[model samples]
Each structure stands twice: as structure tokens, then as C-alpha cells.
Target: AKYRINAFHELSERASQTYTTKQMTMEGVGEASRLGSKIINCKDVSYFWEGGCLLKEFSYNFQRFDKVEIVGRNGVGKSTFLDLLTGVLQPSSGVIERGESLVIGYYRQEGMDFTGDDTVLDIVGDTRLLGRFLFPHDMLNTRVSRLSGGEKRRLYLLTILMKNPNLLILDEPTNDLDIVTLNILEEYLKEYGGSLIIVSHDRHFLDRVVDHLLVFCGEGIVKDFIGSFSEYRSYMRDYESAKKKDSIASIKPQSSAKPEKKAEDKPRKLSFNQKRELESIESRLPELEEKKAAIEKDMNSGALPYDKLKEAAELFKQVSNEIDELETRWLELQN
Candidate 1:
């Protein structure tokens, strides 16, 4: 624990140095561009909760008209980092500094702050630019709760765009959005001139929108690479390869390093309800697989009747959906 604390402190120091260097670099670059002169700066930022570390020693700088993508697996502190950037969550340590003229527009993943009574049109109307772009002309009267998931996402984006902020921070912007809406968002962001820091798992969307990548690995490590998603993937592959080779070369003739002791000795136990659900899922999986195979066989066979084929296709779809839902539930129980 003490060594971990010291490592974190060292990382914080390094982040602070990086932050200072970025600040000086931006100042030297001069600001009189068409996209506005403001720069968004994040200094040695660290956040933790209930003795669990979320973000550790993170720092990045965004200049006018730059688009940066934040990438990492789930629970890697991407959302937490965004919250800190937008002043929603205070960092456990370090500081964040923004330019005096900077304005920030943020879109969160939860969609919680929106009121149900407000129609989609009314919400969009409040963000005049978004209303124009999304529901142009008298369409602002639609109720928010009545809109589809994709429509709600568009409305949310429009609201943030209305602020005309020099910097935008989007957290998991593509999750649950339909493909059509995702394309529209890509088009809009391509033309957007302001700085952007977007967190997303959609690799295609990231490739379309961002020129740089920032990754928080959930350790005390943060990685920054300039280029697209494809480039990031290549870098990661090479890095992993090098790490593997080094690990192999360092192997001792005697034995490998002992595995570290886990904090909890006992394995987590599932409740009766959870065990029942898991068993139910396990029971249905074989049936679902069998049904899926039968449907595929029917569809492939030339002698199958048209009505039978259609029925098989529909049944297959339903079975697949149910299987997906059941698997998600099972995973939740295990976790």
C-alpha cells in the first residue's frame, strides 16, 4: 500500500510537469484563430472514491479547433475524468485551469438531468442552434419522453451545440444511438471548429471525429498518442509485443515471481435468486442454440416452404434477442 502511494505521488509529479510544459507551449503558440483563442487545460488530476482509485495522474491540453478522443475499457475512469474536466467532480488531488474566455458544453451518458415533461421540441428549442439543425421549423413542440432513443440523443447534442462553447466534452456519446443518428453526429462534428474531448467505445466514430487519442488505463498510467484509432491499435499491438518479449527474456531459471495475494481470501458467493437465474440461463442456452441451428438449416434448404422460412427467421431473431438478454443478466450475477 505504501509503495502504491509513492508510485501515485511520482505520477502526480510527472503529470504536473507535463501540465506546465503544455501551458507554456500553448502560450507561445499565440491565439488569434477563427475557432476562438481559448485553450482548455487539465493539470495533474487524480480522483478516487471509498479507497478505490478511479483516475490517477491524468493531464491533457486542448487548443482551439482540436478534437481529442478518450479511449479505454469500461470502468477505466473515462467518465470520472470527464466529470472532473467539467467541474462536476472535484479531484481528490491536483488542479484544473481553463482560459478566461473558454465556454464548455458537456453531454453526459446517464441522460438523467433532462426533465420528462419537456417535449423533444421544447428542449431543442431552448438550444436554438440544435433546434435548427435537428428539428428545423415548428417541430419543437414534441414531448421529450415520446421521442425515440436516437431522437433523444440528437436533442441532447443539439442542446450542447447551442452553447457555442469553445470546448466540448462528450461522455460515451455514441452508446445506444442508432446508426443513422451516429452518421449525422459524425457529419456535425466534422464541421465543428471548436476543441473537443470525447469518450467513446465506437471505434468507427472515433476514427471519424478525432485526430488524437488519450487513454486512461485504470492504473497510475495515462497514454497519449497523436493520430487516429487505427494508429492507436497498431501502437498498442507493438507495445504489447515488446512487453511480452521483455517478460520472456527476464524469466528466471529457478521459478516465476509469486502471484500477489488478493485482498479478499474468500470467493464471492451468489445469492439464491442469482443462482436460480444463472441456472435458468444455462438451461436455455442449449435450447436457443438448437433453435438457431434449425432455423439456419431451414433457411438454407431449397425445399423449405416460404411461410416456414419466414416463421423460422422470426423465431430465430426472437431466440437470439432472448439469449443476449439472458447472458447479460448472467454476467451481472457473476459480477
Candidate 2:
């Protein structure tokens, strides 16, 4: 079917798209001696649990204005790393130095400690900020004990942001947040004036906010990658592919008579970036098809005016062309 072909085309095109680097600058306001350049420093930091090493030889001088995300599989000591950074848990071997003026606002995965008959307004005085977190004016008087689990989490997150700490550490921040609230949080963090350190499984949130990644590859290995989560994933894919090819090369029986190498002998391998692009494309193609289908339906309906019908037709054409180009690219990538 024509619709199916267009869908495939769009998928290919979306897969090839790349992300642009996000850069933002804020104007400095007032002379304040309350902040330091070096936020935290750890030298040869290592932690052990149940006679097994969790983190080892981790040394980094965390600076002011650094947006970092800690990424690893569950039970890989990501939260423990955060605990060590915040002084909740001490490293077994190394020293962690905290800044004198450092005021840390930590949002734990276990949620907030606030409990009792206190109203939401009583807990968070800022009604404007509360509304952004989906707490309406009528909801302000709602008691903390009466609020739902999600509501309680949102209120807790708002409380942390309100502290205006110079160093903000969030563990699993996106867990209880709705999509709209998550958007509001992302926007707030984009303009936030502090150094942000987060431990979250939300890939989109990480890619949107953090500038770099601290990837934990089990057994006390941490790779400090200078890019988004998607980029890091792409790099890993490419690295693994190269290793695989090398492995295949090593096991082959050596021929006493070497065959002549042809120009097209080696098969081209997809780079991690390309693989990521294809993944993104596959994710977006369905959405694009939906848009196209909507446009077609609009055009087919007799209720549209001449101008409106023309507009819908034009849009449909544009989408079709895009799908076609993307499909071509996709095929090329496959080959």
C-alpha cells in the first residue's frame, strides 16, 4: 500500500537525524561570596559492601556549574556513589572534600521525610511553583496525608527545588512525575543556576538536561563520557562491534596461500552514532505516519473549505516526500 511505503520511508529518514548540542548562558547577578569553584573533590575513592567492591579508585574534582548524570544498571551502586558524594556514606579508602559554602539539596529515591496533617500550602508556601507541579489553587489546602502517592512525590520535589541550593543532587527524579510535570521540571532545570547531579533511568530526561555522563560499567569501572546518553550508547555499540570483528579475525585458520584482498573485501560496519540515528528514526516514523494519516483524513472530509483542503493536501504531500527520502536513506544504510 502507498501508506505503508510512506511509513517505511519516514522511518529511514528519522533514523538518520542527529541531535544538536544544547548551549545556554545566564547573566551573572550580584557579587556573592557564597559559592566556590570546587564543589566537591574525591581522591582514590573506593567503597565496599559485604566484602565485595562496589566502587574503586574513583577520583574526580567536581566543579561548579557541572550538569552530570550517573548511569548504570540497578544494584550497580549508583545510589551508593551519590551517598558518598553527599557525605551520607563515607568511602572505604579515599577522602571526599566538600566546599565550605556548599549548600546541597538532595532528593532521595526514598521520597521525602515530610509527614503529618500539614497542608500542601503549609509545606510549600509558593503557590505559583506548586501550580507548575500540578497542585492547583484548590489543592493547596489538601493535607499531606490526604494527598495521593504521586502528589506527595511532586510536593517533595518542589520542596527540594525551592531551597535554591548551589549543588542539586537528584536520585531517580522522574519516577513519580507525570509527562507535563516532567516538562515543567526539565524547563526549570534548564534555567537552573546550580550544579546538577542526577541518578535517573529516564533516557530522554537525561539527554535533555545533562551535559555529560558518568557511565558505570560494573566491577568498579566508570567511564566519564563527554556527551549525551544516546551518544554514549552509540559509542558502546561501535566499540562492541569492533571488538567482535577483531575476535572473528583472530579465530580463522591461517591459509598458507594468502588470497588476494579485493577493494570491496571488508564489509562496512555501522558506527554507534549511525545505529543511534536509525533507532531514533524507527521511534519517530510511527508518529510521522500518524500525522500523515490525520492530514489525509482532513483532506478527504468534504467539510473543509477550498483553502483548508489545499493546505491539508500540501501538508500531506510534504510528509509523503519526507517519508520517501527517509526510506531511500534507510535502504542505503541497510545495504
TM-scores of the models, in the order given = 0.61, 0.67
Task: Please provide, for model 2 over 1-335, each residue's C-alpha lDDT reduced to its tens digit, 9 standing for 90 to 100.
Answer: 01122211221232223212333243142111256766787777889999888888877777656788886766778899999999899899988999988988899978587767899999999888888778999988888998877788999998887776888899988775654577678888887766789987555567788977776766776656667766665565465566557546644475553344422344456889887777676566557767876876676577889898867766765775565455334433432
For model 1, give the 10-residue run with minimal summed lDDT.
1-10
Candidate 1: pairs in clash: 119-143, 119-144, 120-143, 120-144, 121-140
Residue-level lDDT for 161 in candidate 2:
73
Counting only residues 3 or more apart in sequence or on different chains, how many pairs clash (N, Cα, C under 3 Å) in candidate 2?
Answer: 5
Off by over 4 Å in 1: 1-38, 112-120, 126-138, 243-335
lDDT of model 1 at position 260: 44
RMSD of 1: 10.5
Q: CA lDDT of 232 in candidate 2?
A: 61
Q: Assess each prediction's global lDDT (C-alpha) against the native.
A: 0.63, 0.70
